[model samples]
Target: MKYHFFQSKYWVIVWSIALFFFACRDPKQNAKENVKEGELKEPQEENAHTTVIKTIPGGVDTPAGMVWIPGAMFDQGAVAQDQMAMGHEKPSFQVAVDGFFMDETEVTNAKFEKFVKETGYLTVAEREIDWEEMKKQLPEGTPKPHDSILQPGSLTFKKSKSSVPNLYDFSQWWQWTIGASWKHPAGPNSSIKGKENHPVVHIAYEDALAYCEWAGRRLPTEAEWELAARGNRKDKIFFWGDDQDLLGNQANTWEGEFPVMNTQQDGFERRAPVKSYPPNDFGLYDMAGNVWEWTGDWYNTNYYNEVSSKKQLLKNPKGAAKPFNERDRYAKEKVMKGGSFLCSESYCASYRVSARMATSLDSSLEHLGFRTVASVDMVKAEKN
Candidate 1:
């Protein structure tokens, strides 16, 4: 198993299944692993309370389709009432983020198309796989898979015709489809012909960074994203409020049995068009669900432990220098905020504002997308 791991059918099945979970992990399962053997204590609320103080827009002309998020101080993690909170989201601590302009919605296909047309850029999903680089994320001395499995592709979610008993096996629903890039989200047969306004899917971390660089903007830090996604609310599990009843009306998420059925009560089974749902208090659309947005921070399960221990307001804190996912230590994961349409109460339930998930840095999937943010100074410089 150690010498020729990729050659054996048993090992290949294991490897593929491992990759599937790494690509779109079960947030609920990961939550259980984050805690110790004993009962988990929620983050102390000593610094969880804060008022939404308004700040002047500073006379900086706002960018088109971007809203100004006023600098404010607030708790950065799960609150006392979030029973669905994960262990990684523990240790709520006070954090302050400066004013910045953020996209009103996730980056749409039309905008991404413009970037691709102008730059002739190829997304990571479209690029050929490099086993040399990919193996770095696997255990040492792990043999590479056959050449056929190394084709350019991305993970695509397939709805199960019937209820599946093994929710832990992510491979039951996620498929590694060749030619499943942003342009062909569902697979080679699928096309983004009329879904231009929908958030672009299958965007890798580097692809997002490339788009941000071209637009003179950057991905939001986890703190900045949390602040913006919070929409200036105070101690609310959801952006709309603490009410769970409002989830269906406020955002797009799985309505029926997850992976088996979606009632589309929100009028979308998968990713919806930008602004398809009501905006948050800060005028940001789909911040809680629709598609999980990437943050600039690397995933670190214990990062909040460090932040909460500081006992002081952390200003624009970047994430850990490297990723550390307890379940997949070999993979380089990044923090993905907000949830996706696939999220359901029975499963991920990550639609809550504090809900966070992790995916490999090079991983891309249909339910994943990102938005960009620009500092006031960056916007000013772009105009000047």
Candidate 2:
């Protein structure tokens, strides 16, 4: 049920593009209440110093490219007054996660290449489209597209030369480029020649799972991802602190105009090399930007409300059992964390620690990537 209805079928392409637009909505529409520009509300003074992150140390034989994240209890959603916070990030709830070893950075192109070469694997973007399978997510009586248009490809970001009328239309910038896979990120013309150290983009959930299986790891749960992203900073807006001013200096996000112009103020226009920016206090890199990382959770808009209703601290709670986005019921979505280079203050400022987005499980986008985690015992087994 990969929902990559491409450009050939005009209506399907629009629907797919609409999903991207919905996920990356304008910041003005995301605010619960309007506040004066340049003004940010900080958390209550009393609660600011209460929570302390207790990180365990990785032993001498710790797993390669991983860091120990000591588990602790903390609120798992947006802070008190995150103006850019979206509805899906609401109803902050207390949750606990056990210490686990997580990747220091998103899986790199070199590593993914190693996996593909050894297994002769094909990413979702490399696999040919299945008309019958795709039809399941499409409306009834829709005719099968021409075989020529059904070629394998992934969604690629094509920046517009000038600003468009509105940001609501995702089709203005996102194009379904044929031959767009991890090997050829921009399309047939592009290659990962010099970007081996950069994170592997155009990775679908299943593709991530395949790599995790090979590496004896698993995608981090949404709760764990949030906790890790928060790092040693508790109840903060950005992973670094409550200050939005640090965003341009601390993370790889769009500075000037979003699609049309990236001031590259952060010194990166696209996906920066892994660890291009400083790591979080817990020694995790690219937790708030660079690219959106996949989490092992089915995205439900109301999942937070459901958890908040419990009113008790949840211990390592898994996410909603099923995907339930009212916007597009037919397309199944999983939780994606951290914003990409495309995120901006004018657009979706998803680099905040609590920012959450729903991305289709089958999506292999230029801005989508993933990292893996291993339990303490899993790490110990590696020594055997």
Candidate 3:
């Protein structure tokens, strides 16, 4: 069946379920009971309308370029004191958000193949390179690299052994293989074959947009994405909490030696199943680990400073009005939140709740995915 955007009528029905029951019960008394059970209590009936408690399902499957992130605000950005823990997550602030639906997991290879099959869509990587587009933005006299060099693909790490005791070269692991699109993730000769359940990788920003459009959804904005990932926690290191090792099991990561020898404590060297790990407080899965998901906001290292300076309540703050920077100049590098499996404490320690990063809009990787969201009407949501 063809994909359709989430319908408002469905949510209205969900809200109705919440309100109808609460209207007949005493909320204050219920709140106490809820607390005892470690559950969120529905607001007590103050007026004719009563509050409803709705439980949404988590970890549903979707095609590539999608993840489900239950809506709720925790903390956005980071502060100076949290610098050592998370630098980019700076300028921490409390952001109140309404309830909304999100993808339960990242888009998988099997799902993306369906989109390609139904729509016959050619991803940005499959299209021919625009030489003029490339030259217009590159520095003067850069010797216009061969089209072969500019071929569409993603960076994949090739596992290798290191002889030096202390000199493990990580650069050797990252290879920009040609023909490394979603269909052939490892290069021309590779295929999805039995890996349909794996997260779809090597997809660029435009590629994600196409799939979202086909699926009747859009990429989450940076704020929406982070808020959903955080799940109502403020100033915490990881999504679950400050304690990184709360669960002894490693969640979607390379354990052992950096790129050379992986202990596979997480069960896989590459991407893991969408629901392999536990969910956050909001019932969102794979927020902290797995593949990094893309957001709609443009990348700016100092965007937090601007967010802090603004006096207005940034209801749904989108980044800069126009694109900036070299990456932005080309196709506008969008913000990427939620560190990937490649993240390690010793090297790229970005797997924190508030951390942020960016990549070229046209570039896709085996380590990126996305999710969707919608607004929640307070009056309607309460009634539900």
Candidate 4:
């Protein structure tokens, strides 16, 4: 699990699953994952014994810092015109989702800091690598790395000095930076002191879950997240209700040459504050650009195909029960929607609203973050 970007076509299957599956799996199950010593803190559930359904006095109300996303039927995957559609997006099917509350934007650093202060939490990126626990996630005979190099760290992107032709090897730009926690975004030298409004990065699944539990929220399901990202404008190539200039600062994405030079036309070399651009039709911010938001779905290369084969209008799909990599059976990954700031048309054209990426559940990177949903039903399930 590290930084990776899959190509637009069949190549998406192998790399996207392994790269984007970073910690977006079920919160409860992910919490059980092994972390390096002193890396994990037992998450708290104050109302674990209470499973009663709680609705607003008026029946359905919105949660603070969230928008009410009216449910509807929409084409959930690659449409005919989407050239950037990945192989997994095929057999696009109709999906029906119930109305739910979703965050207006990615969880800002200020919001996450409040959760950390309240819960006394430590993200997985802040701890050492628990090789014993990690072995279960990899091939049985995979050799472990040196202990000295296994210290707490997270993936950070490094732009190249000059343009290069080959876009296949993603590791050329992605580096595992020591001390790259949520607080220290780029590395130990960087800080979030004045960046409270920026969306928090380096968030692993557990970190996101802990924040949601503290706020009585949950990560949106794959369908729900896609529905909201569309902003009720189905069939559009991008999330802005129409295809705009992705090469410009239409949203926070690579402008010049990807992984090489960036003009910073949008005025940001790193993360931009939440709501830096106009909100979508649903009044949602950063639905397409900014950071990649973690979805609750466990990714399978053929999950959508399986659903399409069922030949039924799916309802509120939560994704596969577990991650399965077709190319590497031992690898696990989770679905992450909404390509990040690093997404580029020249490389990973994942900025398309339907585009998806997957990676391991333990990976955390500078461009990965998440928002939360406030579905009373989902909260009830979490409590139980």
Report the number of the highest-lDDT candidate.
1
lDDT of 1 by residue, 122-201 (tens): 98788776666566444567666778777788878898989987676666677778789999999999999999999999
Ranked by TM-score, the better of candidates 1 and 4 is 1
Predictions in order: lDDT: 0.77, 0.76, 0.57, 0.71
lDDT of 2 by residue, 72-93 (tens): 8889998987877777788898
Q: 2 or 3: which has the higher lDDT?
A: 2
**Could you tell me the TM-score of candidate 3?**
0.72
Tens-place lDDT per residue, model 3, 1-384, is 010011111111222233211001011110111112211112112222322213333433332333334444344776334544543456654444444456777778888899999999887556555555544443455455555565655555577676323323323455556677788877888988988888888776777877877776667777777777766575566777766665225367656666567776777777887778888776777787688888877665455555555423444556544334432232334678777787666545556766676565555566777765543342233335
Question: Which residue runs of candidate 3 sit more than 4 Å off their true CA positions?
Answer: 1-74, 79-86, 144-150, 160-172, 247-250, 324-331, 376-384
Name the regions of candidate 1 deviating beyond 4 angstroms.
1-14, 17-57, 135-144
Off by over 4 Å in 2: 1-60
lDDT of 4: 0.71
Which runs in model 4 stand beyond 4 Å of their true positions?
A: 1-59, 134-146, 246-249, 376-384
Residue-level error in angstroms, candidate 4, position 172: 0.2
What TM-score does candidate 2 get on C-alpha atoms?
0.85
- RMSD each, Å: 7.4, 9.0, 16.3, 8.6
* lDDT (Cα, tens digit) per residue for candidate 4, span 171-263: 568777778889999998999999999999988777787787788787888888888888757888787645556435457877778888877
**Model 1 residue 111 distance off true place after TM-score fit, in angstroms:** 0.3
